[model samples]
Target: MQWFLLGVALLISGYFIYGKIIERIFGTRPERQTPAFTNNDGVDYVPMSTRKVYLVQLLNIAGLGPIFGPILGALYGPTALLWIVFGSIFAGAVHDYFSGMLSVRAGGASVPTVVGRELGTAAKHFMNSFAVLLLLLVGVVFTLGPAKLLGNLSGTSVPVWVAVIFGYYLIATLVPIDKIIGRLYPLFGALLVFMSVGLLIGLAVSDKSFYAAGITLENLHPQDLPLWPLLFITIACGALSGFHATQSPLMARCMENESNGRFVFYGAMIGEGVIALIWATLGMSFYDSPEALNATLAQGGPAAVVNDVATSLLGGIGGILAILGVVVLPITSGDTSFRAARLILSDFLKFDQKPITKRLMIALPLFAVGFAISLMDFNVIWRYFGWANQMTAVIMLWAAAAWLKRHGKFHWVCTVPATFMTGVVNAYLFSAEIGFGLPLSVAGPIGLASSSVMLVWLLMRGRREQDDLDTPAIAAEQA
Candidate 1:
């Protein structure tokens, strides 16, 4: 309990302290016109109030992530709380801030475009394909999830719900941002807040004690999995996520000022971290032990745990509403996933999105592919998403580091986390069933070596560029 309160306190304080430092390093220029003004297409580039944008950004990057991911991460005990707090403050929020702000600076370019500009053309092309596929996957996965839930709730078939959701996705994708998403998301955001806060209140009043006293740093996994990379990957969205990088650009196009980047981007990630912390605390407290939590998770999955916890804590009607809030999570993010995909394709094709026909030209194929993927067994494909998601974070972080270096601001804030995640992703890739399937001894060293190589290359290259920029100034001073 103390740990939970301390975690919440740190997350809020970090937003004010560390978040401001990041905002300063980015040097947001309020006087400079933003994409909302410069590229006012009324489709994606419409101006929105700061509060609305913050809520929209929060909903965009957060789906079932902060809830589901942290529930899983809680198997690691109180240490999960630490990761959610520190990771969000130091790494996740920073990653989100730069991803969004860089897009705003680039006239609201997509994540791939921002990455390509800083990381080079090769990266741009790779990320273009990677981000589109990831977004399509997000669209399909979120569609299937909500459809299944709605199907069970309404006694409708999964296919019917899928078609219904896909249709909504199309409408949401095609309409102007201010029309559907901007109007409805604040309500969704309210439900999300209510769910989290309600659960916190429930825990406070509960007869049973939830927090385990003096939880240790020791590995608490039932399967005895190493705590290093797996925990990090499991807690991606709540701590750090590459998926947020893709979503941030959607709001970047709608933002009216650069100064709002701190609140909208970094603040959103912190909000998500708090959500993650609540769930993690609940997961640890609600169950008897990590083993009991593991047993329940295996039998009914995270959704079952969510249903049980919410109902048990809040009672019938309140619990149902809380569950509805959970339902809203994926739906809000799913629409934006397709919308982000549409924007990414439009940017890659150099097509104007102002025209409805042009929007369809790009959007139709994306939905087609998403629909097709939805039909097949996607569990195997979904298994790979965790790794792909984190890898995207690594790329975006490096791009942010590069941007900082280019601008001569403090780059380590981005570079340190970028390099650390580089190792994490690499280690996961090597050890997981999806990748090389090597022993941890082999995989850990490989990950370390890979990150070391990247760090050396970035440092050497940055120094050369700095020297090149300085040479002319030095010569002019001498003359």
Candidate 2:
């Protein structure tokens, strides 16, 4: 309990302190016009207030990642708390702030365009496909999961619910930003907040021993999985998810001023970190031990555990409402995932989205691909998402580091975390069954080598760019 409280405090403090530092480093200019106003299309680039954009951005990235990821991460014990606190403060928030702000500066471009501007054309092309694929995966996964849940609740079939949800996604994808998403998101945001806060109060009032033991760095996984890279990968969203980079630009297009970038982007990530912290604490404290939680997870998955906890902690009606909040998470993210895919494809093809026909030209093909993938086994597709998600973050962070270096700001703020996650994702790729399936002894060093190469290249490039900037000044002084 002490650890959880301290973690929450640290996350809030991070927003005020570390958040401001990054905001200053990015040099947000309130006087400048934002893309939302300059490039207002009434569709994706519609202007919105800071408060509305903050909630929209929060829901855009929250998804099931924070809730499910941390519940799984709790298998590693209290060490999960440390990662949630530090990772969000330093890495995740920084990644989000820059991703959104860079997009805002680039006239509401997608993540690929932002990366291309800083990292070069090759990166832009790779990210264009990579980000679109991830968003589609998110859309499909979120779709099936929610459809299945609604099926169970309503006594309908999964296929029926799926068609209904996909239909909603199509409309949300095609419509103006202010029409559906902008209006409904605040209510969704309210439900999410109520659920988390209600659970916290429930924990306080319950007689159950919520804290199994004092905070420990020891591995508590019943399966005895190694903590190094596995814990980090399992707890991506709360810590430092790459997926947020793809989602940040969605809100970036709606921002009214450059100054709102920190509050809407960085602060929203911090808000997500809080949600992750609550879920992790619940996973740890609700069960008798790590073994018990593992058994529960194995038996019914994250949603089952969420149901048991909410029902036990809150009463019947409250618990049902809380569970509804959880359902809202994936659905909200799914619609935006498709929405973002449409925007990314439009940016890539240089197609105008003002016409509904043009929006359908990109969106129809995406849903066709998403619906096809939805028919296959979901677990196989999700296995790649965690790794791919972190991989995207690594790219975005390096791009941000490059942008900072070019502007003579503090690049280390991004470079350090970028190098760390680069190693983490690579390490997961090599060690996990999805990739090489190598032992950690070999994979760990390989990951280190990969990150080291990136860090060295970044430093050398920063030096060259700095020298280029200095050359004109030197010639003037000499004259």
Candidate 3:
């Protein structure tokens, strides 16, 4: 209970303090024209209300990551609470703010274009493929999880739900942003907030005591997954995620004012942090101890926990809330992931999305690939997705750090966290992760060597244009 209170306080205070610091560092230009105004193509670059934009952006990034990831990450102990508060404030929100601001400055460019501008051509080419793969993986993961739950909820076959979800993903990925995503996101956002806030209230009224005893630094994970790196990767979106950076530019193209960047990007991440901490608290408190949560997870997977919590906490409305949390949220994220994939590919190919044919030209092939991956075992894909997700973030953070340095602002805000994430992602890859099955002693050295090489490359190559302040090239680089 004590830790839960502190987590909520920290997440809220971060918006006023750290969120402000990032805004000052990025230096948003209120007077300048945003891409939606300058490049209003209607199909992609449509101007939108700030509230609508915030809701869409929040739902886009909010997905199952914060909820599902936190429940699993709670197995690591109370430390997950610390990561939710500090990592979101320092690392995750910072990454999202800079990426969104960078896209706004670059006239609503995709993340690859933004990376190319800051990190160079090699990184751009690398990110072009890497970002697409990440989106497809997320799109598929979100699809499988939610479709299964919705099938259970609606008493339909899993394939029926898959077909329904795929149909929606096709439309959401291809249609104009204002139609489906723009209008429905506010409703979805309300439901999401209600679910989270309801749970918090339930925590207070319920008989279950969130045992602060077994969830401290001394009581490590039952699985013995070392906290050094596993905890960071386990709770990627709740704490930090590179996936948020990719999704931010979608909202950047619609933002009316640069000053709202913190509200949309940084603010959304903190919102997610709050949600993550709530679920983490529930996971810790609702169980006999953290170990019971782990045992339940191993026995029945994430859906088990979500079903148990939602039903137990909110007795009457639990069924509806369960469907919303386990089903609707992922479907929202899944569709948007496909949308981001389409936009990234369109940006790379120099294709115009103003034409419906052009939109289908990209959407058809992307979903085909997603369909192929969806056939794989869901959890297997998820494990790989987690590592790959953070790896992408490490690159984006470095790119954002370079963006700050070139603009004559403080780069350490991003660079320091980027370096820490650098170690985290690499360490996870080196350890007995995915299929490596290597010992920690051997993995540590391998992780360090890989991270050191990437850091050196970023410092040398990421700043060629950063220091070249004489050429005002921001306008010329729009995607």
lDDT of 1 by residue, 107-163 (tens): 788898788867888999999999988888888878877776667556799899999
Q: List lDDT for all candidates, in order.
A: 0.86, 0.87, 0.83
Which candidate number maximizes TM-score? 2
Which residue pairs in candidate 3 collide? none
Q: Give the TM-score comparing model 2 with the true structure, all chains together.
A: 0.95
Q: Rank the models by lDDT, top first.
A: 2, 1, 3
Model 3 agreement with the true structure over 121-210: per-residue lDDT tens digits: 998999999999999999998988887777656689988888889999999888889999998887787788778877778778987776
For the record, the alpha-carbon RMSD of candidate 3 to the native fold, in angstroms, is 2.3
Q: For model 3, how many clashes?
A: 0
- Candidate 3 local lDDT, residue 109: 83
Q: Of the pair 2 and 3, which is ahead by lDDT?
A: 2
lDDT of 2 by residue, 32-149 (tens): 7877877788888889998999998888898888988999999988899889999999999999999988877777778887888778889999999999999988898889777766
Q: For each candidate, what TM-score against the reference? A: 0.94, 0.95, 0.95
RMSD of each: 4.7, 4.7, 2.3
